[model samples]
Target: MANKKRQTEFLLMLDKYQGTIMKLCLVYTDRHPENVKDLYQEIVCNLWESYPRIRRKNNIPTWVYRVALYTAYTHQRSRKRSVPFIDLDDGFFETVASDSGNEMVERLYSLIDRLEPEDRTLLFLYIDNVSQVRIAEILDTTESAINHRIKRLKQKLKKMNENEEEQ
Candidate 1:
């Protein structure tokens, strides 16, 4: 009975957060449908393995993000791959750095695909509307550090846009 109850609870959790996990997988895998499937499976297995610890946490969403991001990061590092080339239009960077929040947020994934693993995780959480406090918890960093990094991330994108214009 206890085992069955645990299984049911775990399923409920997975069902609730499946989209979030899948999106992270897609981003980490460069939106390759095949890789996304594999990564999604791997993330689920990791989540299940850590479910008990996860359930004990006050913020399940943060725990889920932490596990999913860490799993993606580890999976990415274990693979042997060359740097991927991402080609975008001239205006891509400009829009990313633009004042239009919805448009920028929608296009954020494109930029995420080209970032380092850590930066990608940060922006993924940011765009998901995760609070700075939650993000700090997820990344195991201070809130001020998350703030500083986000500022740097925006400036970096703006600089990239400026450089592209000069080219």
Candidate 2:
């Protein structure tokens, strides 16, 4: 009964954040669909293993993001095939086709694709509009570190945009 209840709770949370989780998988897996799927499963498995340790019900998204990024980092470290994050899924195409924000989103991700893994994770969380404190907790770093890195990232992205405008 306890196991069943836990499974139900897990499923509910997964449903609530499936899109966000999938996006994290894409960003971390370098947009390789196969790798994204693999990372998605790995995250789910990791969440199951760690779920028992969760104390705060309100912090579920933070817990999920932390597990997703950590799994991706470890997975990438274990095997290295420097793949470009350029692959587009059918869903991605559909989104671009239907959304007016396509070009801007694509351009932003293009800049983000150049970031280092940790920075990329930070950018992802930032773009999601996550609070700095929550992001710091998820990344297992200090808020000051998160703040400093975000400031740097903003400058880097701004420079890239400026350079593009000059071209």
Candidate 3:
């Protein structure tokens, strides 16, 4: 009975944060719905497994975001070894065309994809309006470190955009 109650409570907590999870998945998957679904399931499974270890309400969002990022990174790494880019259909464009009003989202994701995994996670959280302190907690880094990384990432992304525009 205790286990069931805990499970129910955890599910409720997750339900409250489902939109955040979906958004993170969308960001990581580059708006590919299929990939988003896959990553979402992976994140949920991870969160459920780790639920018992979560002790503070304040930490839940950060914990969930970190798990989602890690899951996406692992999934990408595994897929890279076995699957070639040509084998996978790029469905993100179609999905974005149908659902999004902001055309810049595609361009933004393209730039984000060029970043390293750690930078991508930092930027994604930053874009989602997470604070530097919370991001540091999630990443197990200092706030100054997170700030430094964001600064470097922004400069790199700016250069990439300028290069793209020149082409």
Candidate 4:
């Protein structure tokens, strides 16, 4: 019965934050559907493993984001050296492109995709309106550091956009 209750609670938590997890996976995986699916499963497994301790925490979102992003980062690093494990069907990129109708949004996403994983993660948290203090907590850094990095990220993105326009 105890195990059943824990399972139910875990399912509810995952359901509640599915969109958040999916968005993180999408961003971290460069919007690759196969990679997104893999990252999502990996994140869920990590979250489940930490569920008990996480549930006791005061801020659930912070905990969830930390777990999801950390898993994505670790997964991304491993994937760099591993052989391409999944051969997604043709037209996958085309299908994804067809789904998004906004040119500016697409451009922005492309710029974001160019960022290093850490910069992308920092930008993701900032864009999602996570407070700098909370972001600091999540990333295990000082709030001042978060502020400095965000400033630099903004400048980097601006430079990236300018370079894109030049090309």
Query: Residue 93 of model 3: what lDDT?
Result: 33
Local error of candidate 3 at residue 34 (angstroms): 2.5
lDDT of each: 0.77, 0.78, 0.78, 0.81
Worst 10 residues of 1 by lDDT: 89-98
Clash-forming residue pairs, model 2:
none
Per-residue lDDT over 3-87 for candidate 3, one digit per residue giving the tens place of the 0 to 100 score: 9999899889988988788777776764555566667778889988988887787778888887877888887877566543322
Tens digits of per-residue lDDT for model 1, 1-167: 98899889889988999889977876787554445665777898988898877546558888789888888888888655645444543453334233445676446666777787777888888888899999999889999999999999898889878987899
2 or 4, which is superior by lDDT?
4
lDDT by residue (tens digit), candidate 4, 54-157: 54556888899989988988999987877655557546433642436788877767767888888988988888888899999999999999989989988987
Decreasing lDDT order of the candidates: 4, 2, 3, 1
Off by over 4 Å in 1: 55-57, 81-107
Pull out the clashing pairs in model 4: none
Report residue 151 deviation for candidate 2 (angstroms). Answer: 1.4
Candidate 4's displacement at residue 138, Å, is: 0.4
Local error of candidate 3 at 10, Å?
A: 1.0
Comparison by TM-score, 1 against 2, better one: 1
Error of 2 at 37 (Å): 0.8
